[model samples]
Target: MTTSDGEAKGEGIHAWHRQAVNDPNPQTLTATSAGHARRRPDHLAVICEGREVTYAELHRRSNQTAHALLAEGLRRGARVAYLGRESEHYFEIALGCAKSGTVLVPVNWRLTSREVDHILRDSDAEVLFAEREFRPVADRLRPVLPGLRTVIEMDTPGSLADGFLDWRAGHAETDLDPGTGRDDAVVQMYTSGTTGLPKGVVLAHRTYFTLMEHMTRAGLNWYDWHPEDRSMSCFSSLHSAGMGWFMVGFAAGCTNVVMRMFVPEEAVKRVHEDGVTVMQAAPAMLRMLLAEPGATPDAFASLRKMIYGGSAIAPPLLRQCMERLDCDLAQMYAAAESGSVVTCLAPAEHTPDNPRLGSVGLPCPGNEVRIVGRDGEVLPAGRVGQIHARTPALFIEYWHQPEATREALVDGWLCMPDAGYLDDDGYLFVLDRLDDAIIVAGQNIYPAEVEMALAEHPAVAESAVVGVPDQRWGQAVKAAVVFHTDQRATARDLMVFLRGRIADFKIPTQYDFVDDLPRNPTGKVLRRMLRAQA
Candidate 1:
């Protein structure tokens, strides 16, 4: 059954999620910056250390960058890749790629040259941009990247450089609007390949801008930017939140104080010094900041909001932050495929006694978050099932992977295979990645639940759980834990502590106490690696 407006709606769907899914105002992503540039030309748009670029100046520079790309014999939809941290040059070139109708591919800087070569060759990127820090690797990749015609090195502040500024300087600062539409491809980001080779996820202008429009139309205040808002752009540009949030800020003509990369102390200093009003962090970064000696309520007094995701926030740490930072807490849930707002645990829902504290929260405007049973029927509240979502903020398609895209994007919904459920009040509690779920003797076990339980213990620093072959049970749960410095614990002690926290069958059958678990650039544990070890 569908809603009157034709959105998929029925018994299991929440009324709170109905409006966003049913009717949405979609806009091209480029409009976010272009509109502000033409309207508020003098407003500050990007600030990276000593450099500050206004909307008017940024518009002109990016226009020149577009002209340079087109002059280099590139055509619409041609690939241009960036391998570095975020900066003024990064944003101008990225936005410029959109204006010229080319796709901007953000290659993870942390990847080895070989892995970097794979993305460059796979994306068929004609032009490459690099910071001085990556010159050695980027230089090594030229031979393998036959299609790469130009390698422009950007001179980052307080870092080492080359012809990027001069290259962008050579072209005329003239508008080159290629008339790219809302659905046309703009950004291509490679996922952190846990199991095999990374796949590029193609995102369009509408995927970034239309969602913001819909949220604004729905009167979501988080979507609205304040007059003097200054956002800390610390997340790497390679991830969804990295570029997505910057685009959102640009659309609102908000000032973004860019950080080349995340340093716990430096991040805190930027907030206090820059008078930042808004910020986003992964739980890992948040933890480090909270532990930093300089971190205090006064240091974060300027902050009005703190957005976090990429993993579940521990209740203990959540309580400390709520009391100390004294700002609204918004735990967001998103994916590279679905873009950022699958759900958000809004500030109002962060009350101390809220049972749904760990939930990813309700859907953002213009999106629907629903749980579905194995039979493909939508499940009612509190029923555990696959968490599927439908939003305009979805990728255009997976680059060169048709079958995978077809299976994932089913029937107007981007069905993320995350096992979760919505409460009666519409809060989403994410259990585990369906691919990561362990089947032991035909009974299902989620590793995240077990890991969370283990995290509650004082001695446990972090952990990664995986399923391994077991003759008796077909598959057995195993955990690789990282204990805190100067803390002590045994596998037996961890097992004992987890006794009442989770099902006995869900407990790890084997434990490997290690220094640390393998993680991607985004801080997601590499469970597949742990399985390989087992």
Candidate 2:
């Protein structure tokens, strides 16, 4: 990556790299001793499966894990795969990798063995840290992965099968060189694979530090955080938002809480019992919490800020949350390539009186957003077009994908393929994906409009709309809905519901009711999967 004014170079990145090189932050150590030095090391840092790991213990264990990896002769920049469901070990291993200066690759546990194999192969991983439950899958693929140097099983002795090294034992807590700087890659996140096969998105140390600085200056109010602040994270560490956000909370010296898996009732209980002040989750998780019985304002009384994103939050759901949760609800819009957040709807703007209730809010400082037409012409306010952005947090490139890198980035700007428009007040409103649009009789119809309309119905809990090939109108609108309960509704009733809300052309020509709709682990509806079923 060459440094040029128009080619994405900034003082923030340079300064952060300089600081890491000169005097590395002691907090970078993933051990309890360092955590104790900051303040109360005995304070809780992780809570999962009814077990708690204090900051001191979490730090110590992570440091030990780092030594174990180094003992295996792992070098800096070596790609190591972390394959497991949510657990305290996930945090320990991830931070351990960071401490060792080895690039961490977190694979989604929801993926099948085949999918996991693809990622391991594509990443050229040298080692794999896997849970005992997934040992069988790993054993099956180990032969195919010639580059794999070791397999560390994350389970107690006698729990793992015969051929793997015990991850917990057999290494001295030796200090390793910490490579901190703008040039060092810290993480490699795979794309969601919604459009196609997933590609690795490499993020550098400078990218993360720059994002934190941008958020702090742009009104995240994160500087107010203290050691007493208890933060909870339900998002997986594999994604940029999950691990990235948690690291920011850690940097602020807050007690970090973790959930092994997201259960709405358990989540509510943890907030009240743990006295969590800040929390981050997807919109679907929020909806589930609100729908639970006995859920009320008191359930979230300890919460100071509730951050939601990764999917659209319908108007009704947002309004209901404001009335019931009684906490500041903030929305963030981001992508892996952009290092997590590009725009955010601040806590103050999340009011009933705010006109841009459904809008994604303004861009962060030093980030530029433009709505451009197909011909690359910039569109005026309120005109729907492709959303493009340029920021210092942007990734260097897609690993080993030169053609894809060239197509996605143009003149230092990332062509986000999402369709949306900026309002006169500069607030952005994402309509739908540019590729997901349907052209019927020369009129463009976005599925998000129909999905939003269907979401208004009391019986409809969640919905997804797609365009299917049609000989008559060139393409036809189709909808797949998941209901709140076992209650059933006919396609005619839904069509009537939409007829009164939107234009006739935008209404779905076909409706399918299923037990549940297909969604990725992050809760993004896989329209391609739905369309394949259609």
Q: Judged by lDDT, which candidate is best?
A: 1
Tell me how far the alpha carbon of residue 285 in candidate 1 is from the true structure, in angstroms, after superposition.
Answer: 1.5
**Tens-place lDDT digits, model 1, residues 373-446:** 99999999989999999987788888888999998899978888689988898889999888899999999998
TM-score of 1: 0.91
Clash counts for all predictions: 1, 5
- Stretches off by above 4 angstroms in model 1 are 1-26, 156-162
Residue pairs in collision within model 1: 20-366
Candidate 2: TM-score?
A: 0.89
Which residue pairs overlap in candidate 2's backbone? Answer: 31-59, 31-60, 32-56, 32-59, 32-60
RMSD of 2: 5.9
Candidate 1: C-alpha lDDT: 0.80
